[model samples]
Target: MKFLHLISIIISSIFLLNPAFGQTDQWPKRTIKFVVGFGPGGANDIVARIVAEGVSKQLGQPVIVENKPGAGSVLGADFVAKSPSDGYTFFVSAGGIITNPMIKKSMPYKEGDLVPVALLAVSPSIIVVPPDSTIKNLRDLIARAKDAKGIQFSTAGTGSTPHFVAEMLKVNAGGKYDIIPYKSGSEAKVAVLSNQVDATSESSAVTIPQIQGGKLRAIASTWNKRIEALPNVPTTKEEGYPQILIGHWAGLFAPKGTPNEILDKMNKAVEAALKSSEVQKRLVPQGIEPTPGSRASFVNFLNDERNRLAPIVQRANMRDD
Candidate 1:
């Protein structure tokens, strides 16, 4: 009895010291879910699905993506934040996750509720107009916006990256435009196609097909350099509004209290997925750049993103309503 008691004590100590030892070894005995805050077909959803497939393969388990789009992705984020931190449920979050709290009056989850797992990808916004519209370029669009009535700029919703783009135009270029909120980026693009709105700044991945199909005209790529998918389209910097730089980035996050070992494993899986050539082939043509980095790197990136967008959100007086 004494020898058995000693063995039990030593085993308990080992498990306590390395909690992940048993947990991670038996982890993911079931399917994993990646919850996305935006609707399907948007850049966030697209990236999530692509990476989910890769992670599923890497982990040798089924990884599925669930879209819970609403409140600028706050709803989906809230869902993931409150989910069990048992390494099965993760959030495929976008830049909005950081900016939403800064802009909204109240958030469902607190700052530390969800922790960064990895940075997945970054997609620059493209300022686009209908193919037949008279707004041929950024210059024309800015001039039109300065008119007394002002142009109507469509966006996914309040606190969204596209909304930031509209605000950036106002703050950096003196372009006055009334914002028109839509259900999603796809709807915003359709509104532009039908001339319901004058223009919209959307993820290059979401708008590149429309531009190539000649249904929309690219005015400016809102990044430092022109997009590879649309080489002829000049960047906002080249168009003289360098301050209007922003990108819609997606990252993975797990609920707080999740084991660091699980986070590290997921991060490695994501990094491996991003490095896959097939993933690159599918992502690069759409102007989506894969950005795989360590968990700490993702945390720093989120902090920087929040710092960069906080001022813009404040200056615009962005609100959930």
Candidate 2:
């Protein structure tokens, strides 16, 4: 009888110790941290906050956004890449994740250090000028750039998607337009708004408000399709410069080795958040389009992005250092 009892006890202990017993249980018991690579008010921050609200409700726990902005968003991305693989920590980053490695002499973390969780949004860049400037259309802008001695353009920063798009214009349009880099997209927008710079291609999120207020004019968009906020603006494709079709995108990622189950849960939560009406209502006007997708899909998207930009980076000889 003792032998039988011992056998039964062992079986019970084994069952209790089995990972499957508690695998799906008590997850997300504490607050989850969502790290943003950009400072407040940027497209990455805005998208993370909006999604955090929805994710918080979906997960029944608070989702906080911690901004560690700098190094063109590399600071925040590296933080998450080195963080514990527990599901509690996630990252919200922009296109810099792919672009940085292409240009920067070195990076603290490899691009593969983070696993793609979800793609949050795609924000097209807009080529804008101060309202009173004479540059009215994409063709005219290119012509003036080639004709003038010092046609200047500004972008959020070097290696940023906007910056690359500006470079694309210079290389593809075969113009001598000089690019002026700023610390942030807001600062770059200010340069164009104050006429400190002749033009700038900035995230539509940063330009839409001013465009609507008549402070700036939208001459062209980087998106293949016209953005709703700037309905009248032509696309780079429409302007005969399809090579400049680059824009900003936001996505979530977890540290490498993070359990696939955790990644899936976060992915589902983000999808739910993205589909929520609140997110749509808030982000669309800011020129952000929510792109909630699965882990595999996000990975494939990243791969495609790399392939698309590889030629641009190589041909332009763009480098961060």
Candidate 3:
């Protein structure tokens, strides 16, 4: 009896200290759900599916992509944040991942809502204008806005990164511009191309073809340096608007409370997927650079972003969602 009790205590200790003790038998027992906050056909969904494709094979399970877009991706984000942290549910988060909390005084989830699994990629935005517009470039656009009625820019909804990009530009230039919010980056780009709206900021991945096909004209990139795909374009930093910095990002996140062993496994799978030639081929050519950050590093990055943007968000008095 004494020996049996001692053995039982030892076994319990092993399970407590080590999650992988039985993971080989329990992990991925069923389909794993990969949740994306944006709709299908967009960058987030596209990246999520690509990562899922690789992870599914490695995990020996079907990794499914689920869309739950709404409230600037808060609906999906909130869902994942509150989900079981069992490593089954994951989030393909966007810029709103950090910006949303700063704008909302009573948001449902904090940075703790989800665990930063890895930084999948970083897709910088492009400052685009109407194809037929007289604004030849960033300088011309700023010059015109200096004399025109408030410029009208469109973005992927209010409280989004593009919206802030436009705001930051207008603020930096001391020019007045009213940003019109659309449902998606594609929609906003269409509005600009159709000449319905004045201008908008979008990723090179989505806007490069349009700019090349003469559908939209890219004035500048939001990053400090030019993207390889759009070698002709200059950076806002070079364009003399150093304060008007803008960048859109995407990353993988696991629901908070997920088992450490399972999270580790998932993180490894995602890292491998991002590093895979297939993923690099699909993303790099489109100018979506990868930001490969570790789970802890990403967590620290998120905290830093939240703090940096809180003051900007408050100063703008932005509440549009």
Worst lDDT run of 10 residues, candidate 1, spans 17-26
Clash pairs, candidate 3, are: 85-258
Choose the strongest candidate by lDDT: 1
lDDT of each: 0.89, 0.86, 0.80
Rank all candidate structures by their TM-score, best first, as comma-separated numbers. Answer: 1, 2, 3
Could you give the candidate ranking by lDDT, starting with the highest? 1, 2, 3
Candidate 3's residue-wise lDDT over 166-277, tens digit each?
7787778867777788888888888898899888898877888888898888989988778888899999899888777767778788776677777777777777778888
lDDT minimum window of 10 residues, candidate 2: 17-26
Model 3 segments more than 4 A misplaced? 2-26
- Better model by TM-score: candidate 1 vs candidate 2: 1
Residue 179 Cα positional deviation in candidate 1, in Å, after optimal superposition: 1.5
TM-score leader: 1
How many backbone overlaps does candidate 2 show?
0
Clashes of each: 0, 0, 1
Model 2, runs deviating above 4 Å: 1-24
Model 1 regions lying over 4 Å from their true place: 1-21
